[model samples]
Target: MQRTILIVEDEDILREIMKDYLLNAGYRVLEAADGKEALARFEEEEIQLIILDIMLPELDGWTVCRRIRKKSNVPIIMLTARVDEDDTILGFELGADDYVTKPYSPAILLARAKRLIESRYSTQENHPYEDTLLSRSVHVHIPSRTVTVCGEAISLTHTEFEILTYLMQNQGIIISREQLITKIWGYEFAGDDRTVNSHIRNLRHKLGKCATCIVTVVRAGYKFEEQI
Candidate 1:
């Protein structure tokens, strides 16, 4: 089945370019010129992914993302032209699965979109960690893709969940930022270390008391150690 992607960009030329690439990549494409129209299309279609631009009219991308996250966990990749690192962090905080800045290669954007969509809809029956990963009070059920701390469920964005799972899967081993970028966002990831840091910060916050399980190694990377 051809996956459907909604492109919410206010720029007509850029939107058409993205739509063309997605169509050629064998995906069904939907388009909206503004945030409000984006929301309407979202409500009307079975959108598998969203490529949203920040500077939209009628409503901003941040507002649209926050609203959609309330109802669905569908993958969303935010598009921005700003160089501010805070914008990237804000996107993650608003439940965005990926971020692409302006002047980006449409092919790279498509790759990111594909990665998120596939990861979300993967049907692999035999995962390496079929059982639950219990480290101290943090419980990660691989099959169900659910995380619970002290038996209390906590919400995690897709990227945050992947980061924690990878860390826990290789507990006691320091995983570098490069390794994480390749594993989670693919090699096409054009962001810097701050991207990883932002996600880690958010993940740790959600982990609460169990946050100590993830230890940062100065000048090295990060590792998961069982914390009691």
Candidate 2:
């Protein structure tokens, strides 16, 4: 079945443009002119992802994003006109998987949309039902999706968990940022490699002293070293 996407924007021209591009990309597109209509459509449809505009009639995108995050982790990409860093960070804090600044490229937006959708579905597909045991000072619990470093549970975000899990599952194999982005972030990452670097930084921060389990090869990628 073709994945469904809900686009909430008040601008008719832009909305239609986005819809056309997404449709041609082989996605089923749904459009709402305002947040009220968007919420109504969301209730009525099995939407796989949402493209939300920050400025909307009756209700704003931030509120809509908050409402959706309360009940679902379905990926959302926020559309904003401002270049304010706060807006981007706030969107991420509100559970937006990504953001697009307007007047945006339809192609870039489509690329991001494809990436987010594939990331969500790919993680679901790659989720290991079977368990694995790791002997490193860190013990990763696949079923619970948790990592224990020296008997202390290390907190990790969903993305971090997925990245670590993928690495540990394929221990000793050098994996590149491109591979991780493709496998973990879902689609071909068109953005800077810093995105991957930032996530890895956060993962290591959470890992604390046990971060050494994840080895970074210079100019290469990363690998999970089995502890002796």
The candidate maximizing TM-score is: 1
Model 1, 1-228: lDDT tens digits are 789999999999999999999999999999999999999999999999999999999999999999998888788999999979889989988888899988999988988998998777776564556567778688898767789999899888788888999999899999999999999999888888988988899899999988888999998999999755
In order, the Cα lDDT scores of the candidates are 0.90, 0.79
- Model 1, TM vs. native: 0.92
Candidate 2 per-residue lDDT over residues 1-228, each given as its tens digit: 699999999999999999999999999999999999988999899998999999999999999998886666577888999887667667665666677888889998998888777655654347554465575577777655567887887755556767888888778999999898787655644444665676677677878887787899899999988545
Clashing pairs in 1: none
Candidate 2 displacement at residue 163 in angstroms: 4.6
| Residue ranges of candidate 1 with Cα displaced over 4 Å | 126-128
How many backbone overlaps does candidate 1 show?
Answer: 0
Kindly report the root-mean-square deviation of model 2 from the true structure over all alpha carbons: 5.2
